[model samples]
Target: MADVVRPSDRFRQGMATRRRVLGDAHVDRASGSATPFDQPFQEMITEGAWGTVWSRPGISPRERSMITIALLAALGHDEEVAMHVRATVNTGASREDITEALMHVAVYAGVPAANRAFKIAKHVFDRIDAGETGGGSHD
Candidate 1:
């Protein structure tokens, strides 16, 4: 069997990344709604996705953001894609990287998914540019 990974470190690192990428307001909203049913799941994501995977030393956050954006777009996860899109600003992914990722999604994930992802990304970018609070900060 594979080694069982403890999540303490992952949780801490993931929380930092989550806070940096998603901002305190978004994190607060997520934590605020944490119920008995979802708390465990939330922790799992924090430790596993944010902490372990995202905290790995292999790639820079910018590279990870690009890959994440492409994957989310391809998977038709528009909301997640949008969130990550906003995260690109902090990761230094630039608008060009996102455009290329969406283009790849259009080719591989289907135009519909790419279209929706683009729309959501645009909206998020607009909100960010407008300096809306609660949308999270990159740094």
Candidate 2:
């Protein structure tokens, strides 16, 4: 008989962590779109990144939020930048924190990237104020 595969505790932990950081609705959309082709890749990130790395101690979610925002902005990952900005609400990062991080991006990464990050962040905060989920459109 073939051995059956099961989810590891780390995967479960990652799922919980992902849900906490990304929110249930966002995670649910990702989960609902899972296919056989991407299942393994999804599981890998769930366990390795979310479960193992993000769930680690030392840095607070606040610190991680600042770091994540800067990295995402530096890389020009506009959508992820906005998403992480929304996560700041849970992470206790203020709008000032995000602005400061983007300032770092401007000096270290580039002005264009920081400019776009600022624009994206403003759109996200606006949507949030309009009572919308900071979900949708990574483009």
Candidate 3:
């Protein structure tokens, strides 16, 4: 017989944090679609990204959201940038805050990367303003 696996304390914390930041619908979609192949990846993010980094108290979720957006933008992670931008609703980050972060990204990362990120962010913001809560994956 296969033994059932209980989630760890860290995983629990991560799941809670993830849900709070990403929302129930997005988290539900991600959790529901997890296959055996990507299950470990999902677990790793829950335990690492959400549980460890995001759960830390030194910074606010708003700060983390801005930093995440900047990093994703700098790295040319278009989809992730949009996803995080959408998540700003729950993270308490304002559009002005995101614009400031992207401005920094332009100076530090590059014009091209920041420009593309700005376009993506604008599109997401437009959708959000239109009363549509869906922009990125499962959002």
Top candidate by TM-score: 3
Tens digits of lDDT, candidate 2, 4-118: 9888999999999888888888888787788998878888889997899889999988888899899999998887898888888777899999999999999999999999999
RMSD of 1: 5.6
Measured against the true structure, the TM-scores of the candidates, in listed sequence, are 0.85, 0.91, 0.96
Quote model 2's TM-score. 0.91
Poorly placed runs, candidate 3 (over 4 Å): none
Ranking by TM-score: 3, 2, 1
Task: Tell me the spans in candidate 2 whose CA falls farther than 4 Å from its real position.
Answer: 1-3, 137-139
Residue range 1-139, candidate 3, lDDT tens digits = 9999999999999999999998888888888888998889899999999999999999999999999999999999898899999899999999999999999999999999999999999999899898887535632
Model 1 accuracy (lDDT, Cα): 0.80
The lDDT values for all models are 0.80, 0.86, 0.91
What C-alpha lDDT, on a 0 to 100 scale, does residue 134 get in candidate 3?
51
Go through the candidates in order and give the clash count of each. 0, 0, 0
Total clashes in model 3, counting residue pairs 3 or more apart in sequence or in different chains? 0
Between prediction 1 and prediction 2, the one with superior TM-score is 2
